[model samples]
Target: MNKRKPLDERRAEIVEAGLSVALREGVESVTVRRVAQEAGISLGTVHYCFDDKDAMLRAMGRSIAMRASEPVIAALEAGPDRRALAEATVDALLVGLKEHQEMRLLTFEFAVSGARTPVLREVAQAHLTQSIAMTREYLQRLADVAQVTWASDIDDLARMTALRIDGIELAWMVDQDDAAAREGFAVLARDVFADMRPELPAG
Candidate 1:
């Protein structure tokens, strides 16, 4: 008899299959049997990894959010000046969105699931909170590094910026017009950052 794949590997495969199904046919189509068929595993195997559809959906959401944030985090750590940091943030978002179109679809499906399922809702809220916190930290770090002060409310601005990013991502997923999406995001970022320039000393 062949040895079974490790539990972690099996779980990862199931999640990937679930994401594929959700992206292609929508979340309602991602039943345990469907995922098992997609992953070439038994339904029991899918159950062994996830408690139920809700659990699978939550796992999928977490995975997509983490994968999408990677490039943004990397760009922030690239030691760029403030303008570069701002542009990198926008560019990273656009590239990540374009590269992970399927993941974005899955994310939207999970969000809709959250509306009716408490567990999924909690998971979504937690993920959003974590994302916003990370955004706030990155913005604060950029301000400090560039010796820029924000005359307006920093926390409020950060939250607004993050929400704008989330909106742009969802819009881009549907529109798939990369040039238009990038231009819109660039304009938004430029306007936000430009408003703070007077707070910094002359370069």
Candidate 2:
């Protein structure tokens, strides 16, 4: 007989299955029954794993936030000058967005759904907070590695960076134009985030 999977692993599988459903159908269609079906598990199993739909959604929110951070983590591995590293980080973000465009679009759908749905607001808010904090950490690490700083307040700058990326990703999702996305990100990295570069050091 097959041994049973642990609760944590089972929960992760259910979460990923739920995301796959969202990626295929719109976020609004992600009912617990639907997710259960997608996961090929019993309704009892799902119920055992999650308190309710809201709990499942909360899991999905965390999953998306974790998915979103991976590109930056990978980009951090490529050590280079501050400018190049910033550009690499931005490019990695765009690449990750492109690679998982469906999931990314679902992220927006979840946000919009949360805004209109009372039960989901906190889940969405938590994801948003986590995303901004992840960006802030990325910015902070870049600054530390490059020995530079943003002229503006780092807190505010992190918020701006997160919003700018959201706007760009949304535009790309609508247009399906990768070229325009790259151009937009290049401008974002070089022009918008130029504040990340400080003034020259005197002799």
Candidate 3:
């Protein structure tokens, strides 16, 4: 007889199965039954780990947020300069969006769903807050690399940058125009870096 998997590992496997369903057939299809089927587990097994489908969805959303942050963190670590890092980060984000358009759409769907679901709203807000903080840290690193003092408030700059990226993603969700979106992002990113350049101290 096969030994049973550990609880945490089994839960993670279920969550990933749920994510696969959401990404493929949209969030509406992420039923416990479907996830159980996808994972080749029983419904009772799924319920053993999750109290309900909503709980499983929350876990899946958190997992997605964690997985998405990996490349961004890597970009910050390996980037050469402020502008180059920022550009590389944008490119990475767009590439992911293009590759996982369905996932991108599901994220938007979850956000809209969150407007009515307090728990989900909180989760989404927490994710966005962490992402903004990460971006702020990246900007600080950029300033350090350039050996210049950033003139603007990093908090405001980070928030704005986050908003800009959200807008771009929203546009992609609507238009599905990766080529245009990327082209526009390149120009906008250049202008953004120029605008946020470090201020020179007057002699």
- The prediction achieving the highest TM-score against the true structure is 2
Model 3: runs farther than 4 Å from truth? Answer: 47-52, 116-156, 187-203
| Per-model lDDT | 0.76, 0.81, 0.73
lDDT per residue (tens digit) for residues 1-203 in model 3: 96899999999999889888887787768789999999999999999999987778778766765565556556655455666666776687777667666665666678776677675686566556765776677677766655665556889888887677767878988898888778766766665566554643344
Question: What C-alpha lDDT, on a 0 to 100 scale, does residue 166 get in candidate 2?
Answer: 89
lDDT of 1 by residue, 54-134 (tens): 677667777887787788777766443767777887798788888777777666666676777775687567656656776
Error of 3 at 124 (Å): 4.8
Report model 2's TM-score to 2 decimal places.
0.85
- Full candidate order by TM-score, most accurate first: 2, 1, 3
Please give each candidate's TM-score. 0.74, 0.85, 0.71
Clashing pairs in 2: none
Residue-level error in angstroms, candidate 1, position 122: 4.9
lDDT of 1: 0.76
Tell me, what's the RMSD of every candidate? 3.7, 2.7, 4.1
Pairs clashing in candidate 3?
A: none
Predicted structure 1, TM vs. truth: 0.74
Pairwise lDDT winner, candidates 1 and 2: 2
lDDT of 3: 0.73
